[model samples]
Target: MVIKPKSLLKNKALNKWNLFWLISGPISIFMIINLLAVDTSTGAGISEMIQFSVRWAVPFVYLVIATSSVQILFPGPFSRWLMRNRKYIGLCFAVAMAWQALFIFIMSYFFHEYYYSDVYYFRDEIEGSIGYIFLPAMVLTSFNFGSKLLTPKQWKLLHTSGIYFLWAYPFSVYWWNLYYYENPVLIDYVFYWVGFVAFALRIVAWGKQRYELSKRIDPNYKTPIESKMLGGLFIIFGLLVSASGLYWQDLITSLFTCFSMVRRT
Candidate 1:
């Protein structure tokens, strides 16, 4: 039996449960390794584990946020796979966060003084608590049994808002890493651009869709030349914000702060 590569991709590559564990299993294993490897003797050790788990989680969330937009902008097999497994990808994120939550509990309970003094910030705590609340709700609704409990609109509302809330956590962290911190690491810049492109793709896709819909609704409808020129300018301006982070640092920092993730360690 000869298997064609293309046929294999369509027929069996990344089928649901396989894809889920394929991503989630490794993430879980790494968290376990961190548990064993890191010195659990101090709250500082637990904090490193929390940071490790967070790095694993953020990329999956970003992929979920960008999935649909990727399909819209560039229709292809890779994008289609992402669309199909968006739920599983999100579940992978949940698995990673679960590890972070476990470490958080260990810190808060066992190393109360260290947790309170070094790590605790009231605004960050509030945001993180809200994120945890949404996390389980999203995981529950990802399955049909829990989803059956909500109307279609209700389900949509929960997931949409939850995704944005999750995205904001890391986006703000990296935002500050680049602009607000004295000495930012290389990984910080990598994450900041990856996230910037993810959200930017969605915005560009939205504008494309709005134009297409307007044209379809009324054949006579024509976007003015001024609007077209303004669209180009908007793209350039957004790029400028990315390139010249220092100029807009203060305002962007203040705005993104205290919302979902006001402050990040």
Candidate 2:
């Protein structure tokens, strides 16, 4: 009996978990507020504050949670759901980004705070140069409507390129920080490094699958074991270097303070 997947999502426990993610907004908000409160009191740098609050403490976690949930809960049906519903996700991201623009505008104008103007520009230039390109490419490939418009080979190339862009952003950020002299922290570390893991996994899977592919060797592959191992080690080193960039003590201290007070109450 092929139990319909959507029917399974209706199970009480599964429904609760879905509701949990939905309701987690409040908890995330509170956590961010607490983080901001402590940072403000402690005089943390604006960039570090924003990075911790938005990138690390919130959006990245949300991204991982949402993607992981779709994969685990929906599986096969998830693909169809994503294809049918990706526009909604894109639209939501667009709307959130638009709201961020509005917020930045208000901050720069009404509040007379221009500190983040360059930060905004830096992030925009990087993401537009990279993330924007991939997202559109993925949207095009994953959409049945767009896929039909491109030849399979063309779509495959574009889709593969998009995946590449997705992986490249972290390295771009690393270099961007060096170029701009901006410091990154653990959250930034995790975001980029975790992404590297995904990228490395894909490469490993491809290489393993093509180990004896006599009729179909990847032109990109090198036959040398040393090169392959070196590439793997580079991925590990990147993660560690990125992780080393984090503001760990500050985060741990603030988090512990918050929990300790709660426990005392």
Q: lDDT per prediction?
A: 0.88, 0.51
How do all models score by TM-score? 0.88, 0.46
- Return the number of clashes found in candidate 1: 1
Pull out the clashing pairs in model 1: 258-262
Model 1 off-target regions past 4 Å? 1-8, 11-13, 219-222, 250-265
User: In candidate 2, which residue ranges exceed 4 Å CA deviation?
Assistant: 1-117, 120-130, 174-183, 212-265
In model 1, the worst 10-residue window by lDDT is 5-14
Candidate 1 residue 6 Cα shift, in angstroms, is 4.1
Candidate 1 per-residue lDDT, tens place, 111-207, comes to: 9999999999898899899999999999999999999999999999999999989988888888877887789998898888998899998998898
Residue 80 alpha-carbon offset, candidate 2, angstroms: 14
Question: Highest lDDT, which number?
Answer: 1
